[model samples]
Every structure is written in C-alpha cells, then in structure tokens.
Target chain A: MLLVILELVGIAVFAASGALAAVRARLDVFGVTVLALATALGGGVIRDVLLGVHPPTSLTKWPYLLVPALTGLLVFSFHPQVARLRRAVQLLDAIGLGLFVTGGTSTALALGAPPYTACLIGMTTGIGGGAMRDVLLREIPLVLRREIYAVAALLGCLVVAGGSVLGLPEGPVALAGSALVVAVRLLALWRRWNAPVAHGLDA
Target chain B: MLLVILELVGIAVFAASGALAAVRARLDVFGVTVLALATALGGGVIRDVLLGVHPPTSLTKWPYLLVPALTGLLVFSFHPQVARLRRAVQLLDAIGLGLFVTGGTSTALALGAPPYTACLIGMTTGIGGGAMRDVLLREIPLVLRREIYAVAALLGCLVVAGGSVLGLPEGPVALAGSALVVAVRLLALWRRWNAPVAHGLDA
Candidate 1:
C-alpha cells in the first residue's frame, strides 16, 4: 500500500516536471504527452528491463499512460496557478525523488540484487526517467549536471542498506532513507548547489 | 549474406537520419551520438525484446554502440556536404526500408510467426528505429504521419509473402519488392503525400 501510494505520487510529480519542460520547449499537446510519459515511467522501464522483466509497467498498463496524460492536461490548464506554486513544486519533486530512490533500492534488494547493483538501481530509479525525458526534449540531463540530484538518490540507497544491516524495521528504514534524500535535495536547491563541468571531453 | 547486408545498410541510413535530426535540434556532439544510437538500433532492440532475445544488440556488440558515434562525428564534420546530397539520402533510406522489411518478415516467418504477424514485424523492422528516434526526440513518430512510410514497408512485406506463394526466385522477389517500395516513396515525396490524421485532434 505504501509502495503503491508513493509510486503514484512520484508519477504525478514527474509528470508535472515533464509538462513544464515541454512547455519550455514550445511543444504541443502530443509532445507534452510523450514527455510526461517518459518522465513518469522511464526509470521503471529501465529497471524492469535490467531485471529481465518483459513489457515494463508503462507499456503493460494503460493507467500508467493515462495518469501522465491527465497530469499534462492539468499542467496546461493551470499553468498560471502552478507558476505561483514554484516552491511547492520543488518540494514535491524532492519528495518524489526520495521515494523513487528508496523504492528502487528496496525492490532490487527484495529481488536479490547485490548492494552495489542495488545502489545503482536506486540512483537510476530516481533520475532515469527525468534523464530520458530531458534527452528527448533536447536538454541536458539534470542528474549528469549541476543538480546534486543523482547523488541524493545514491545517499538514500546507502542509508537504506545500512539501516537494513542494523535491523531497522522496513517502514522506518524506507522512511528514513527517503527523508534523507529529500533533505539533501532541498538543502542543495536552497544553496544553489551544482556539479563541476570542464572544457572538452572527459576520460 | 543478404540479411546481413540489408541490416547494415538500414543501420547506416538510420544513423545518418538520426545525425541530421540531432543537428537540426541544435544538439552537441554527445547528443548527436545518443540520437544516432537510438535511431539506428531502437527498432531491433524492441523486436529482440518482444522475441525474448536477451542482451539486445546495442549492449552485446561494442561495434553497434561505436558505429553510431562515429557516424555522428562524420556527419558533424561534413554536414554541409551531406546536406547537399539530401536526395541521395532519401533514396538510400527507401532502399534500406525495403530490404529491412523483407528481412524482418522472413525472420519472423522462419521463427514460426503467422503470416499476418510476420508482415507486421516486417513493417516494424523497417520503421521502428525512426519511430523510436522521433519519440525520444519528443516529436510525433515519423512513421505515424509521414507519407506512405508504413505502407511502403507493408507493400514490401506483402511482395515477399506473395512471391513465396507464386514460387518466384527469392532474389528476384526481393529485388522486385525493393524497387516497388522505392518507386512508391519517390512518387509520394514528389506529390507531397501524407497520411490522414484520422482522429482529427485540434492543432
């Protein structure tokens, strides 16, 4: 139940981000729907593929597709109202990222993936969809640049793994990891956090 | 031998298209490589997954990953010269699509897929990469609205199936199908053809 609720929340938040990004790119309704779908379900699709699960959730479930479309419509209809809630949107996005990372790690662990792989999955789960959406929108991926985004997800995964070793209850462990991620993201945003970029290609 | 040649030609054409599209979208070198990979290999990945093939070609072969990057660099360096040969690009793309459709259908048939399914697979094989590239680029799938794009593939598939029934030589049948598709595509382009947007969504 917790998983389902949090997953839906994450979808909604990501969908909003996707819609906003499409608007920034001057995309029409069709473009908006496609971007929202990528942002809302891309991470899950990648995780499922890596786990050898076929027909990932986005393709198998029509609701998963519809939810993003609805969110796109909402974003379009209430653009002005949403603009006024910029801080709220940022806070919700942080919460969504936290939940996604914890969910990815916990699910990978449950499925018997190793700690390192779980951490990678956790980070991907938080940011993969966003990265794909940005790439599709022809924008640089947020996680690969100056967002402090994927790092937060990585730290959340570490927290969860450590808590499990300490015999923490599953609920608290998940909650605590998620809280840490959210705190890091919010703090980073407040501080104008950024990753370093250099000239030319990297080794 | 034919299948391998056809697949290579299809990959090369799709890579060129991907590079051109990325450049038009104002993406840098890295972004062009990403688009090229998606455009040249995405359909095969989808087909392999649906057919339960593991470790999709893009992941299995370093060459498959590297070739697109090289193509991107080449295009980036010689874009002006390449752009002057746009007609040649279209002709190559048409030939590639015809061969890919036949190859895809024959493979599906050999794998015990029914005739109808085999034909559909053929069409998928021909246009799947471009569709995926457009989707990833946040554009309406080129196959979805482009002039007789899917139909051209479908015609080639039907010819292959029909030739088998008529006991025609495989080489002649394939040549005939390729010629037919190229003719149709050329005529469509000359006439400024397009598929009807049946749903009639508001602009």
Candidate 2:
C-alpha cells in the first residue's frame, strides 16, 4: 500500500514537470497531455520493456494513465499559479526521484537482474521520463547537463544494490536508499551543485 | 538470410544518418557514436521490448553492436566527405525506412498483436530511431516535422497489416508493402511534399 502511494505521488510530480515543460514550450493541448503521459510513465515503461514485461503496466492500468492526464489538465488550466510554486514543485520532484530510484532498483533485483544492470536500470527509471520530456520539447535534458541529477540516482541505486548484495532486509535497505537519494538531491539543489561539464574538443 | 541482409542494410543507413546528425550538432566523437548506436538499434530494441523480449537482441548480440560502432567511427572520420553525398544518403534512408516498416509490422503480427497495434508498432520501428537521434541532438524529429516521413511508414504498415488481414502470402505482401513505402518516400522527396504543420497559435 505504501509502495503504491509512493508510485502515485511520483507519477503526479513527474506529470507536473512534463506539463510545465509543455507550457514553457507553448505546445498545444494535445502536446501537453502527451508530454505529461510520457514524463510520468516513460521511465517505468522503458524499465519494464528492458525487463521483458510485455504491455507495460502503465499502458494496461487505468489509474496510471488517468493520474497523469488529470495532472496535465490541471496544470494547463492553472499554469500561472503552478509556475509561481516552481521551488515547491522541484522539491516534490526530488522526493519522487528518491521513490522511483528505490522502487526501480528493488523491482530489477526481484527480477534477478545482475547488480550492475539493476543499478543502471534504477537510475534510468528515475531519469528517463524527464529526458523524454526534454527531448519532446526540443531541449537538452537537464539531467544530462546541469545539476547532480543522474549521479544522485546512481548513488541511490548503488546503495540499494550493495545492501541487497550484503543480504540486508529489503524494506530497510530500500528506505535507506531512498533517504540517500532525497538527501543528496536536496543538498545539491540548495548548494547549486552541478555535474562537471565536458571540457575541450575531444570530450 | 534475406531478412538478415535487409536488417543490416537498414542499420547501416540509419547509423549514417545518426552520425551526420551528430556532426551537424557539433558533437564530439562520443556523442557521434552514442547517436549512431541509438539510431541504428533503438527501434528494434523498442519493438522487442514491447513484445516482451528481454535484454533486447541488440544489447546482447555482438554484431548488432559492432556494425553501428564501426559505422559511427567511419562517419566521424569522414563526415565532410559523406555530407557531400547527401542525396545518396537520403535515397538509402528511404529504402531502409521501407524495409523496417514491413519487417516491424510483420513481426508484430506474427506475435499476435492486433492489426492496429501492429501498424502502429511498425511505424514506430521505422521512425523511432530517427526520432531518438533528433531528440538527443535537441531538435524536433524530422519525422514529426517536414517531409512525408511518418505518413510513408504508416502507409507501408497499413499495406502489410492489410495483407495479413486478407490472408495473403507473407513474403509477397511484405515485398509489395516495402516497395510501396520506398516509392512514396522517394516521390515525396523528389516532389518536395510535406505533412501539414499547424498554422495557428502556439504550435
């Protein structure tokens, strides 16, 4: 039940981000909805596909589709109000990132993927949606450029995978992993920490 | 045997297009190679995943990885010369588009997907890689913009799916479908045909 709630919250936050991106790009209503759906579900879909699950749960489940669609509609109707709370939204997004990373890692581990692949898939699950959103908006993905985004997810995945490898209990390990992600992400935001940019012509 | 050759040719053409896009974006060698790999195998990987195939063949198979990598390297070293033959590249790309559309649709049908779903998947397989390449380069996908790109793929898919619905022989139907796509795509290029763009507010 708690996991379900976490996933829903994560979907809502990601959907909000996607809607904001569409608004910023001045996209039409159809585009806004498409972006919202992609941002909220794209990562999970990608992960599921990588794991060989056909007809991704997101596609088959009604709530997964409804939540993002409604979120997009709400944002479209009151974007000005939403835009003013950008900081709050980013914080929520960070929380969502934490939840998604843990969920993804646990799921991959349960599916018997190698620790390394699990870690990578976990990180991808956290960042893939936003990357898809940016791509649709014709912009460089923020995760790939600025902030300690992908790195934070990676660290979270590493912790979770390491704990699992050590035979730690799943619940506690997942909690610890999520906490790590949230802490690192909030700290990076507060401190304006960024990943290093590639330097020189060969990078 | 024929299918293998067709797939290889498609990969090479798509990889070339990806390398050219990376070059146009002023990306370094790493970006070029990444784009090449994404464009060459992304669509098939996506299709496989949708069909519940785990660890996509492209990811596991050595040749799939090697062919695109080599193509990327070649393009990176001689992009200027390749760019000069833009017309030839487009011709090859059109052929690749046809082959991929037919292959994807047939594969989906064989997997027992609904005809509509098969058609959609086929179009996705034909266009998905290019779309990903454009997105990575921070550009609107060419398939989504100018030219009859997606439409050509859709038409090809329709023919393939339609034949299956009519209980026709797979080989002849697939061949005819591919021929239709190639003809339409090349005609569109020669005639400078384009899909209509929204002419209103906030496109």
- Candidate 1 per-residue lDDT, tens place, B1-203, comes to 76566677777788888988888888998888888888888777766664446777557977677776788788877888888899998887787788777877666666666555566556667777887778667775665446677667878989987876677777788778878888888888889876432121233
lDDT tens readout by residue for model 1, A72-129 = 7787666657757999989988998998889888888778888778878888888898
Which candidate ranks first by lDDT, i.e. highest?
Answer: 2
Residue-level lDDT of model 2, residues A49-102, one tens digit each, is 798766778899899999999999999999999999989998899888988888
Write down the C-alpha DockQ for each prediction.
0.09, 0.17
Q: Provide the lowest-lDDT 10-residue window in model 2 chain B.
A: B25-34
Runs of candidate 2 exceeding 4 Å displacement: A1-45, A52-109, A113-123, A126-130, A136-138, A142-203, B49-57, B60-62, B195-203
Colliding pairs, model 1: none
Docking level of model 1: incorrect
